[model samples]
Target: MDHQTEVNVGGPRMRPVQERSDHTALVVGDFLYVWGGYRSISGEEIFFPSDEICIYDMRSGEWQTRPMEGDIPPSLSGTCGSYLNGSMYIFGGCNDNGHSNQMYCVNLLGEKYIWKNFTEGVESRPTPRDKHSCWVYKDSIIYFGGYGCKQIRDVHPNSFTIDEASWAVIGNALFRFWGWNNEVHVYDPCSNTWTEPHTTGSSPTPRAAHASATLGSRGYVCGGMENMMMDLHYLDLESWTWTNIVSQSAVPQGRSWHTLTAFSPSSLFLFGGLNLFCEPLSDGWVFDLETAEWRQFQHPHQDKPRLWHTACLGLDSDVVIFGGSRDYRMLMDTIAVLRFPSLGHCSDVLIFQTQPYSLLRLCEDCIGKNAEILEKQLSILPLKLLEPIQKRISFFRTAVQTDKKITCT
Candidate 1:
């Protein structure tokens, strides 16, 4: 992290909890649910899993602790989860004993919420592991590579269509991660079956702690460190191909334990995590998937670096962030909310955000276009579109004058 970075807590969330890291938290309706992670006790760091569910209400901006009703999960970390339908599905993580292949679900909207052991009656389960990435894809929870019984790196149901294949063994399984995997596995929520699908495109290197969010049929993963990943990849669920987003401007440094949340359908917000130097980063980023561009969100206004924390988008463009550690300081049980300024309207914008960057890169094409075509295009350029393009050109012009390379577009 740069010296200018700051990580002050935001919003109205103001209670203190034990300093913790590697905890899993997700959004369900009006509440953000936080569970199991490692916490410090008398200078001895330990797994602090508890049955108590930590609930943060977006509407009230308050914390409410509730006890679990059934089959409470044990103390653990590295487990990942996704919210689908009305319940949140949590799968495999390690505990004091070891890694667990167990899967559980809790109904967030129910009056009396209880944990359900959905792992029961399942066949062809992913090996017990932690640091694995999983997201809800339609009717299934799609799981990607992680650490397990051993390093697993194969895509299930590889290459061929879903057939009358046995769950015991899959046909056409593509071996992606001989050591670290980029393989994709689909877990059916209804049948409780796991299938490895054949993917066609080149895959990401075996990585862990990478943040993922579902955008339509694509899953966006960004800023994970197999070593140090500033690179971003999106998997097309239908084609099983990966597209790496190459952006101009200053990209957020590669870091893990950072949180990535889809604040808007077309955009995502990524915030605080540790850098390659093991420094707590207060850096923030806004990724416009529509433009495939990464816009850095300045963090000079805050004073705490968030690492291993979780971010959830609440109503009215608010980013609700939960606890994570910053260097030696385990954070207070504080909830911070960063409110994004309104960008007004794009309801009539017709220009592609990437086009400006593209035009800046390849000027000949812009020069070659007929005045009629260009006039039509320029006529509808909304203030939203014009502002960024002007900014990019200004930024690029300065770079050109400075003899620095233009990485835009």
Candidate 2:
């Protein structure tokens, strides 16, 4: 578990494992499954409304492709899918004509794909949507905000239980926050309901196209774009409230359309998306819940900057990041795996010498002048104020550089 080195796992050096062109991915068990998407063919970019499903098994380090059986749902992008209790449920993506309202389930154990049409009588079925997020919590599939024909709508979040086979909207009025409403909806099958708790202080501006993951009872919402954001937010299910956790080090840029995944209960990871300037990002970061801090992990062998990519937690403590759009013109098939650092062994550091020098040099190129001033004040004071000032300085640096890059061409 080396913290600095990045291993390729079993994918192409330049591209991710699966390279079809247009397809979105979902991960379940030990394998990553990708379905139909559009790609370039001949001279023009063509949409392949395909039922071809490809699987990359992490354990075996092999790739397998299979045609979806039965009447497959039309090929679409932005469709959300998740695995629960040995089944994968997919819902709501856009086709060539308009948004899709179809729901389908694949029984991983039974090896069968089942489609359910929810166009008829239902309390709500999430009006035609694509680019929304869906997660299986308890026994229900919960869906959040996405794009429709005209505008991106943050409709009342909806859910569908396996037993009832009907859609029900939740947290309609109790949880109200305005702006870009791309939320990650999680259902507690035990309560048979969905909850989006409110966050205190300044919440990450309402954003769509972000990513989220649940660890134990808490759900983490990270890197998304409203106008611009590089911060992280967490929803404590037990507390039913959102808390903006200040990042502790230099972090990735404010990005949307990225992926956040939970590998273990204490470890969360994020990778690849477009920044506020619409430039693609290829870096990665990890969050430690115990420390309540974020650490940027350098991937020495990662793919190029990309947005709209997908990532998932794999076996042992490995995270898999897959295909995404490099730019409007280029789509990617690159994949990278991140292994967590081992915390058991302690490193021995020989004490050298300590001296206080000009603090001005330390803060010379610092982004936030006010923050640097505070840091200088705290350094001379007691240790109690040092922690808070250090935290603020770290966050300021991250917020400034997350997407500010100087290109020398």
Candidate 3:
């Protein structure tokens, strides 16, 4: 990875010192695409350009900032996104103007990615919202709790359904001030329509910035802030039944803007968020689905606090967390990788075989000799070499810091 090389992909080259919060990151094949976030520099809050995307090639350890064309969404933050089929769908975020209920899709299967606005002419849709949670299950995207203005919109009465218990909880509050919601709105691509699914059992309270992930037929939601929520709930997609999880083991505090990622079929990794007092947290936990136990996750970067960051299941099931705020005032561009022994097949000692500097030199030699052939082949290089290349790149990023003083570790 060449941290020093700057490549322009139409328009202005993206800043290298980028900071973000309320962003979304999704791993597609070997590349991780990051989009829709805001950063606070000094006192000004600047949302990242929605026309551009930051993509990280995991195999090559390279970062690219490319301009996106065709029906790009407005510069916004706190939007929710999900990956389905060969495209990524983005929905509902707030910009400088206000909130939106629009939905857009970017086709990743094609060589030239094009964003398509699919929300046009949609009669029934969720109200404008942000800080919501969404996950793709089966052929539809399950959109849950979000913070949005309470506006009564006409819905398809037959399709709009809610559990009796959830209706009692939400009742008339669905049409009140800028409020949080517990609505289960399902968007089916086939019909390009949004329907409020009638869920059963007890539904969680209306909240925002909560984390959600799907494992098999179940969708799990944890930690959010309406009144600083700390509950855990899952809706069985097959049955549309909500079940609140009660853990015998100690669990992490209630938080909003945290992330819950399912690293495996039976387990999930939960990380940083804001507590009841709105303070950022750095703790990590792993929830076992079989036993319904919460176990503390031990890693080196526990002291690093982050919230509103995007965590994706990277190669080898490692949790790749990127760009969030530490204090809600100061945003960050830091990327942290957390490895759990339970999720990966390779051990730490064997993951990186040679020294960082040496591995990079060998890769450069391979590319120099065969250019085209080796450049493409570099992505498939042994994991032993790939790991250290990342470490080497990190050293380059951290050495200069903001002071520009090169410090050797």
Which numbered prediction scores highest in TM-score against the true structure? 3
Candidate 2 global TM-score: 0.61
TM-score of each: 0.68, 0.61, 0.75
- Which residue pairs show collisions in model 2? 16-333, 16-334, 16-335, 22-37, 253-402
Q: Which runs in model 2 stand beyond 4 Å of their true positions?
A: 1-22, 41-45, 149-204, 238-240, 329-409
Candidate 1 lDDT at 9 equals: 17
Q: Worst lDDT window (10 residues) for model 3?
A: 341-350
Q: Write one digit per residue (lDDT tens) for candidate 1, span 1-409.
A: 2211221113333443444567777765555677777765555447764676666544333455666678887778878877777777888877657678888888766555688887777887876667778767778889886654433233333321121222223222432122234557898878878898877665666666677777788887776646466877788988888877778656778887677777667887787777887677777788887687788765332455666667665534456666676563423211111111111100100011122233443442232233334555655778856543443344434434544232311
How much is 25 displaced in model 1, in angstroms?
1.3
Whole-structure CA lDDT of model 2 = 0.51
Deviation in Å, model 2, residue 152 alpha carbon: 12
What is the per-residue lDDT of model 3 for residues 160-245, given as tens digits with 9 covering 90 to 100? 22223333344456643355677888999878988887898988877787899999999999878654546789999988999999
Residue runs of model 3 more than 4 Å from their true location after superposition: 1-17, 152-176, 227-229, 329-409
**Weakest lDDT window of 10 consecutive positions for candidate 2:** 345-354
Q: Model 2: per-residue lDDT, tens digit, 1-409?
A: 3311221123222222333332456656555666765544453334444455666554333445554565467777667777766655666665546557666666544444444333344433444555566544446555555544222233333221111111122122323222234444444433434445444433444445668786776556776544366777766555556678886666677877778787766877777776777566667777787887778766542445556666666544456555555654323211111111111111110010112223642353242337645544555856754543454354445434543221110
By summed lDDT, which 10 consecutive residues of candidate 1 come out lowest?
A: 343-352
